[model samples]
Target: MPDERTHARAQIRGVKETAEADLLAKKNVIGVDIADKVTDGKNTGQLSIVVFVEDKQPTSKLSAADRVPKEIDGVPTDVQQMTVELQGPSMQLVDDVTPQVDTTTYAVLHGGISMGPLRSVYLTPPDVTSAGYYIFAGTLGAMVRDRGNGATMALTNFHVACVNSTWSVGDRMVQPSLLDGGSSSNQFGSLTRATLSDDVDGSVVTVDTGRSTTPSVQDIGDVAGHTAATVGAAVRKRGRTTELTYGTVISTDFTVTINYGSDVGSRTLHHQIRVQTDTSRSARFSDHGDSGSVVMDNNRMVVGLLFAGSSDGQWTFANPIQSVLDELNVDLMVAPVVTRPIVSCLNTRLVVCNITRPVACLFTRSAGCNLTRTASCLVTRAVACNVTRATWCPVVTRTAVTCSVFTRAGCDIPIPDPGPIEGGQSEDGHGYGATADVPEEYWAGYLAALEEINELDGPDEA
Candidate 1:
């Protein structure tokens, strides 16, 4: 969200203005305290009437008056009467989630994402009961291309798509409002499961509007024509709610954590990210309403999608553009590709794994091989080690680059099954047969890497 100075200040002014509007919208009744006859002493049987302004402020101008109210408090109401504040506006959230926004940043993104050059569409799990209504305002670094028929698919965070639930196949998606355009891109898109991977979040009854795609601020001192940036390169993001911001990919060892879904809340992807950015844009990057902002590189190649970030932008993380490609398996490459690292076990000399490579993560062992490469690495009290083959599966974004182990059960944390009519099961990478679960194209890459590492005996001495 934007800074309180700018956004909040403006909002405060606006809220006050609105409250002043409703200042006279006061209605009172001759009511009695229909309590269980409790004793606050004085009015055990009678209740006091009150008057209030309906906005962010809580205290109403009229306290629990012994008499009924005389006016319908609203804008026409006098300032003195408007000050007749009441308890309500500053109450708990009523719907989705509270959009913690900096008014200025909201103004920015509200212009762009809600009204950018070409409106971007996002696919989220639909409310089947609502006839598959889409979750508007999603972010995407890349989209998916189906291997089955080479169809294009939307790629975004699993949580953004409502993973771990029984969503009807081919559900619809909705885009958010931005800029001057309200319901501008009111088009709906269809989605089939290309891939889904989400972690757990704590037990919350429902997702807030904030969790989906809220707002934040960033201040990119106008780059000429928005010439984009690249990996190992610095970039800036201009958000709808946030102004402009900068950040470094400290690590993409993307491990998100979840507390609710593993059991009680019974769903995954209710989590947050840890980002790393400089102090200039660090104070604020993105917030609640800025969820679907596309993070452009210096080159503006859309390196990452700005979904979540800290209030104070100290450290930040992003779902890599490459990872999005791998997840949905698509290509948005307008720039030449650079070679990535190779992971191997120094101790076992086994060809190690790359978690976010968007390709084969684990490779078979090469006898006598002693080196490995992984884009993500972490040095705990113990030495920095390969994340894939560790005993514990280190969460990618939420937990940072921690050691992760491979066990069928380890990755297969139970998510609730779909309701009776919506029958489908999440994949569990099991033993040999599980290998079949690997797509042919994905397996081909793995086989090539494995053969190279293991030096599989070729047809010899024929």
Candidate 2:
């Protein structure tokens, strides 16, 4: 699919262009917990920092001995506290070490995990800083669809659809310039309500909305009509933050390391091949202001999702548009409207689903399914299936299931697995947060806490 206009053009083309692709191979980490998104549709590009209770500790003044951790009177225990910082208006990049203040008093005991003021916090929004633990840094692009039929799904990078793990399909999104802080600017984008992919170890949940007029996607430069390069094609991203960052496609297909909560994960991914450029159609590779920006080809069709990148902005990656489109049951590359026929879990097919349900349940796909030999089926029909490529798990709505096979290809009925996947929690990297299954008691305190946060933050302004 290499397009002519997107043929590799480089400022220093002679130097790094020929370097063979290098894979990170393993995750660079010890371990850390990070959440997905939060949102309130406005174009001003304001993001809230979801600092964990642990990271909110006042590191400024610590006692030698770990004090009994409890708050007295109306004060919060250091463990129950977090700092809230905002980027000033005009999106100025704040480069200071986000000061961890001592919100605790002498009455409250404090201290737990000692996180550096540096690495963990997005000192400023995407334009100036990032905590490096954001969601899209991992998972492939995301899809939002209705809760009923899995058919009406729309695809975009998780960062685009979500901000801090709070995405509700049908919600409007916007980008605004602030004369002052916290004011919603005039620019706005309307997002249709669709299901969200489950959390790190979960599946997808369909979100249904009755709203009409979903925006037709336009490539960064409307590059869809353009031809796609095989491997060495140069790619660029035009997003909400880091407006435009240029980088070469390192590889056509490769495995990328993603850190999702406790585990280090790798997904088979593809890129059009790009490198950072000083000027990408007059936009910086990425600035703090852009989060959901779309990457495009020379002809301007979308190729990648502009999600995460570093400060110097050397390496930036998208949830290759191609992969997500296939998983979410959407179409990629418009003209031909090519689709890999859905694999049926008939005889000899292996499937995996995140959770289990009867044939009637919605959104749960029987994945890693092997039909013929699966414990569930004897298969009356034979289908052409490929085992060579490690298949991706299917996106289903609100259902919890492990992979199971059916009697035939494309069969909706759940047949037992020839080779059942190990656990029922998650088979794919996509995280499914089933609010339905979760007991209210578990997060009741969190809800209560947010109520207080609303009171303190003075009811989040639109």
Candidate 3:
């Protein structure tokens, strides 16, 4: 009586149950998940199971690829590389040299919602009293609505919301964090779910009905929508520490082990989007208090939830948006559309000065505006560029030469010609134009675009 999709899912579950122990016992194999097969950027519409394998390089003599099986219980299986460490609940120490923000100032600027990145703090008795309270701060990822009941919830990292998995359900989470002068009055939500697994390192807090909250991310504006991330997509985020920062997707499906200090040791996270810092901005994309910040693509769609970063802040990681939505059983609140102010350029064409926030321009391939090169757009007497929402370029080229910030780190001033510019400009809330070395900052994003373009052109061009 079940549809093929449902039947395949069920069969895959059975295969996992039967082979989980043996499969996990194999080298590098840690976990399993079910998903549809994607071929040539299109979903095959056929269900398949995913097997998780760990380590920097997944390979083995016992099995074909690290002992991973191509099929389980007659269902096709795919392997995902991940990192596993032995980290427990503990606050990450903030480095003095790392770029930091003043919590009190930003909290006052945003209002209602307590916002800041890192500081010292407490979690109270049951969660942890040994060190009094754990001192930590992470970005409040976003406000999500439960799929079943439509109840609003606060999304953040397990380390941010659950005290590194120490806190249980019903435990209160405070904003400005305890270390930033947060107390009972600032309690925003209670832990409803926590996941420290192969798929995610996150938790959801059921926000108290009485508290003031919005589905909007500070500085960057509203959550226009949600989408899965692809390598090379230009993304941005507003966090407690950095306020607003930008970066490029280096790898969408990546795995790495994280060292969570001595007591917590380390833990492996699977299916993560690895992002490198925008060289044009501060060298680091995020700092101590950035964990739990929700990353949005150029089109303002939720892409992933930030969790960890390297000491230098150059490298950062996140759980894919789809995985978070599924695991939490929640949906992002879609921001409403609003008309934006337009400016007339040289009295010949009307140009939308700021189409990146609050309202998105939907004119793709409209009259006089059909430039859709990777991360770049051009329009004359038009509403929007022909570029897709997932595009890395947000720049709009016009005869008037007024350039707006694109979503990717490499996006910069509009060039007269349509040939792809070497690199993008930097967006750190500063009006920086593209430099000759812009490509260096956006090498990762540009490389991905080049690969795609090369594939389209075929073997001769390659």
Candidate 1 lDDT by residue in tens digits, 1-462:
324323433333333333322332333211111011223333342111122222222235445532223322321111111111100001111223233223221222221232111122222323122222222333322323454555444444443433334434444443332222324343234445533344211000111123222122133222122222222456666544444666654332223222212212322221222345656645655553444344555655555544444333443434455444545545442323458554334544333232222222243343454323221111212222333244442322222222222333324333332221211111243221122233555445554664565454222110
lDDT (Cα, tens digit) per residue for candidate 3, span 268-366: 666688777787965667776677888888888888888876555666778998898888788877667888544323342212222322111222232
- Predicted structure with the largest lDDT when compared to the true one: 3
Q: What is residue 292's positional error in candidate 1, in angstroms?
A: 4.8
Query: In candidate 2, which residue ranges exceed 4 Å CA deviation?
Result: 1-155, 164-229, 244-246, 258-274, 278-284, 331-462
Instruction: Return the top candidate by TM-score.
Output: 3
Ranking by lDDT: 3, 1, 2
Total clashes in model 1, counting residue pairs 3 or more apart in sequence or in different chains: 90
Number of clashes in every candidate structure? 90, 104, 22
Candidate 3, poorest ten consecutive residues by summed lDDT: 354-363
Model 3: CA > 4 A from native: 1-133, 259-265, 338-462
Q: Please give, for residues 82-141, the per-residue lDDT of candidate 2 as tens digits.
A: 221111011222332221211111111011100010111132333335433321111112
